[model samples]
Target: MWSSKYSEDIKEKVLEMYLHGEANVEKISKRYGIPASTIKNWISLYWEEEQARAERSKAASRRKRRFVNGKELRVVRPTSGSAYIDWRRK
Candidate 1:
């Protein structure tokens, strides 16, 4: 099977064009010389990532709102090298 490698920048631009109502999948496929199915796959992947990011932000915000001694405490998560945390506020 032959595969074509498209850079992230090109994928993002094509998805943006489709999302902004500037063109349909068929037209975009023709213009960019990409298959309609490939374009659709890119759009689907973009939406999945976006939904995951939204969910992560929501969970982080929920974790941030904690009460201790009638005072709100902010929870901070380390951004690197650690996946486990005891989020209980002391």
Candidate 2:
């Protein structure tokens, strides 16, 4: 698909204007010379991206960071009451 020459800042500003009810698609279309359909597309795309980002953050927050199935390190005491370092995995 061919991309527009308009910068992201301009697109974002247009989207904000439309989303905030400051202007309608047709009004913005006239002011910025962008098609109404293109503005609508940007709005939908932005919404989808925001939803995906929210879901990703929620998933990340739901995960655990604790050790899972890893070997533990500790000191061992024998019958002779001598403490020795145990570096073997059990």
Candidate 3:
């Protein structure tokens, strides 16, 4: 199947405009000459990407160890157990 390709910059701008309340989907579509459905898809895609990025950052922070009393401590979850353990305690 043939598909249309749009530049990343245009996608970002369209999403930014919508998210920032600068314009609604219909207005943006008219201004950009893109279909309303296409604009909605871009908005949804941008929102999902933002959510995934947030989740990744949270997971990364959870994985990082903290320094306390000159010792690095990490919170670890066992694969076979539901309990959480502090690495410094064991």
Candidate 4:
């Protein structure tokens, strides 16, 4: 029987590859000796998180576009020489 602790880590790695569009659930399950259904569940959770992240990024961009509700912001360079903060809003 697989332990919950190890299964959790395996689930993370499986979901990572799935989210990156590299592997499907069946392949991941075969590689990890886990069930396809479990892999599918993990993939679903990963996609949900990915969607949430995309939503957050969209919201952040929208917020950066307009001076709203006195939100405190910290500027960080997303790339080298891209020193302008909130450049995504542009």
Quote the lDDT for 65 in model 2: 41
TM-score of each: 0.69, 0.65, 0.64, 0.52
Predictions in order: lDDT: 0.78, 0.81, 0.79, 0.69
Best by lDDT: 2
> What lDDT score is found at residue 82 in candidate 4?
75
Instruction: Indicate whether candidate 3 or candidate 4 has the larger lDDT.
Output: 3
* lDDT of candidate 2 over 1-90, digit per residue (tens): 225887888998998998899999999999998888988898888899889999999997886544325754555677676887655444
Q: Candidate 4 residues 13-36, lDDT tens each?
A: 876788788887788888888888
lDDT comparison, 1 vs 3, better candidate: 3
Candidate 1 displacement at residue 67 in angstroms: 7.1
Tell me which of candidates 2 and 3 scores higher on TM-score.
2
Over the full model, what C-alpha lDDT does candidate 4 score relative to the true structure? 0.69
Reference-based lDDT, residue 45, model 1: 81
Query: What's the C-alpha lDDT at position 19 in model 2?
Result: 84
Query: Which of 2 and 3 is the better model by lDDT?
Result: 2
